[model samples]
Target: MIDLFHCFGAKPAHRVDTSLAAEMLRASGCRHLAVNTHTIDQVTAGDDLPVGYDTATLGSVMALVGEELALSPVLNINHPTSAAEAVKRTRQAAQLTGIRVIKLEVLDPGFKLSVNAEVVEAARELTADGFEVWPLITPDARTFAQCVELGSTMVRVMGSPIGARRGIEPQHLEPMGEMLVDSPVPVMLDGGIGSTADVEQAFALGFQSVLVNSCLFADGTDPVTALAGFRATVDRVASGTPAAH
Candidate 1:
């Protein structure tokens, strides 16, 4: 299942982005819609955004995406935080949105990028709470193994220049796949998953699922058509058919 994520923050680069993304996401064959805890925290204050986003907070967005859309809601607790605090926040999110899986934004946001100890601890705690944890991490052998050891049900691999829309580079794929080949847990590809071809490539490299954004909705790419391709590819891959070239 593809988990397509978007921030849709109070101050997005473009207001149209917030609305356009929401529209595209509804049509996209995404299994889950994810937002970080910070956004959820802001919206709970009862006033922080304009019309398109005013009603699109975490809880409402969760409700807005029903089964017909084939969309589930997920919360990403991405912030500098302790294990206990992260678990508390996740419990709050689960109460609010009924989200199934929680993503630990364990990786810091700045010049230096690495998964700190807090996130690993949080993953352990959340797993102990019987909550599935999806920790976002860069493509690294050691980190990947560590997350696997921590009982991560799935680890979402981030693109370099993380969150900078750079997507995943070609050189990384082979190495990333090699590092993750024998992982017991399924790995979800996060960055540079652009087309049906990308879906095929990711699966070939052992990705059980992927998270896609930017490529489909941005650059005037006709999101509905793009979304349809992804849907078909995911179906084909999941069904054990030969990956469509």
Candidate 2:
């Protein structure tokens, strides 16, 4: 089955309530949920959140959601930064939250990453400390091979430019798909997933999971409703049911 992984980013006003968000996600058919600490300030500020509700509490809430849902530690340790500090923060967050995987996104151009070595090294350092690191990088097979060598258990390839929902760029997916087919680890697709058709297209090309953020955090929409919509589409696509629109 093609798993649906929801990424909780910045939330707009009239956003989904935390309790409802938790309930809906638990009821939804998604395999995993990635609660992003990176955008918490943009989404919810002091007094705007429910009592005792904060980004740090999200991990425990998601944990109560179910064992099926794995909370991804959103570490945005970009390039040219202190790799040790990044690793220390990531390790502290993981140790405090008791989550298993830390998700890293590379913010550089080209098919191969050149500017995010520190972030990569930090992830490597954390992995050596018994943490599972999942870094999202370009779809280049060679770069991904190096990532595997660096102790990344899962690698996410952008289906399109991040946050642009133009749908899966099938050409970019071909080599990554082939690489995923031969690798023992999971290869996930992030960005550019617009509908059920897109999910099926990616799954057929050998992606193990889809990470969605903007699609689920729609304006004036609650997480429960948005998640239900995405869950339905993911199921239909996984079951070979023709996509609607």
Q: Number of clashing residue pairs in every model? A: 0, 0
Off by over 4 Å in 1: 1-11, 14-26, 45-55, 62-67, 79-88, 98-100, 111-118, 163-167, 194-196, 236-245
**For model 2, the run of ten residues with the poorest summed lDDT:** 44-53
| Tens digit of per-residue lDDT, candidate 1, span 101-169 | 887755454522436466677777888777888877767777777778878888877654443445467
- Each candidate structure's TM-score, on Cα atoms with residue i matched to residue i, is 0.72, 0.72
What is the per-residue lDDT of model 2 for residues 158-202, given as tens digits with 9 covering 90 to 100? 777655666677577577766777887888887666555676777
Q: After superposition, how far is residue 5 of candidate 1 from its true place, in Å?
A: 7.5
Best by TM-score: 2
Off by over 4 Å in 2: 11-16, 31-33, 39-56, 59-85, 108-119, 219-222, 241-245
Report each candidate's C-alpha RMSD, comma-separated, in the order given: 4.4, 5.4
lDDT scores in order: 0.61, 0.59
- How many clashes does the backbone of model 1 have? 0
